[model samples]
Target: MNICVFCSAADLDARYTTPAREFAELIGKGGHALVWGGSDTGLMKVMADGVETAGGRLVGVSVDFLAHKVRPGVDDMVITKDLAERKAELLARADAIVVMVGGTGTLDEATEILELKKHGLHTKPVVLLNTAGFYDGLKEQFQRMEDEGFLPLPLTELVFFAEDGAGALAYLEEQAGIQG
Candidate 1:
């Protein structure tokens, strides 16, 4: 599968990096490809490196402005004109989506994808890897949305909340009809 992962590009503590690396390793060792923002720093770099080292392919979708930060020697790279196009390209290339702990940029990507899925624009499985309980609040918010009827579909159908990398991948694999 071409798993698109949206994550921070900023340097972070080991709590975040460890699980991200572990998830990336799972992507690679499973003979899957990584579709991501294509930054060569921080958590993004950690994921890309882990995936590449574990024998997975890297497919980076980088915007023109941040092209300088794109990783070197990825299996494939595409420079989009802007963020909108970049997200579209990433989604187009991915069979599944994983949203890791991140800031506004990552959150933007995650919500947009979920919104698209909610509208039936796509049916690809989405997983929010809530590493270190970073997304506990967001998970609650989603539940509230479901409870309040703000979301047409159940929150569970819209996205899966995973406490760790293994659960995230396992869910994605099962959704893809790949036995763990």
Candidate 2:
């Protein structure tokens, strides 16, 4: 499977970065490829390094203006004309999506993926790694949306949440029908 991971670009904390690396390593060792933003900083770099270290394939998607930020040594890369195109390419190439600890950009990406799934545009599994309660607020917001009847369906039906990388991978395996 080609897993797309949305994560922070600023390496502000090790709490998030460490888990991101572990997740990436697990993906590589499991013989799964990664589709992610083509940035070399923060969690992106950690993830790319982990995948490369474990001999997993890496497919990066980035805009032309951010070309300099693309990680070196990626197995493949898709350069888009803008952010919208980049997001489309990432979603097109991914079989599943993982939302890691990140900022606004990550939130935007995660929401877009969820929206797509809600609209039946894609059936790919979306997993949120809620490490250290990082996504507690977002989860609450989702609940509020459901309570307000603004969402067509429950958020739980739209995405899955895991406490850690292992849990996330397990959910992915189950959703993707990968045995052991």
Question: Which candidate should be chosen as best, given TM-score against the real structure?
Answer: 1
- Assess the local accuracy of residue 77 in candidate 1 as a C-alpha lDDT between 0 and 100: 98
Candidate 1 lDDT over residue span 1-180, tens digit each: 999999999999999999899999999999999999999999999999999999999999999999999999999999999999999999999999999999999999999999999999999999999999999999999999999999999888999999999999999999999988
Regions more than 4 Å wrong, model 1: none
Best by lDDT: 1
Candidates in order, TM-scores: namely 0.99, 0.96
**C-alpha RMSD values across all candidates:** 0.5, 1.1
Question: What are the per-residue Cα lDDT tens digits for candidate 2 across 97-118?
Answer: 9999888989999989999898
- Give the whole-model CA lDDT for all candidates, comma-separated: 0.96, 0.89
Residue 111, model 1: Cα distance from true site in angstroms: 0.6
Per-prediction count of colliding residue pairs? 0, 0
Off by over 4 Å in 2: none
Give the RMSD in angstroms, all C-alphas superposed, for model 2: 1.1
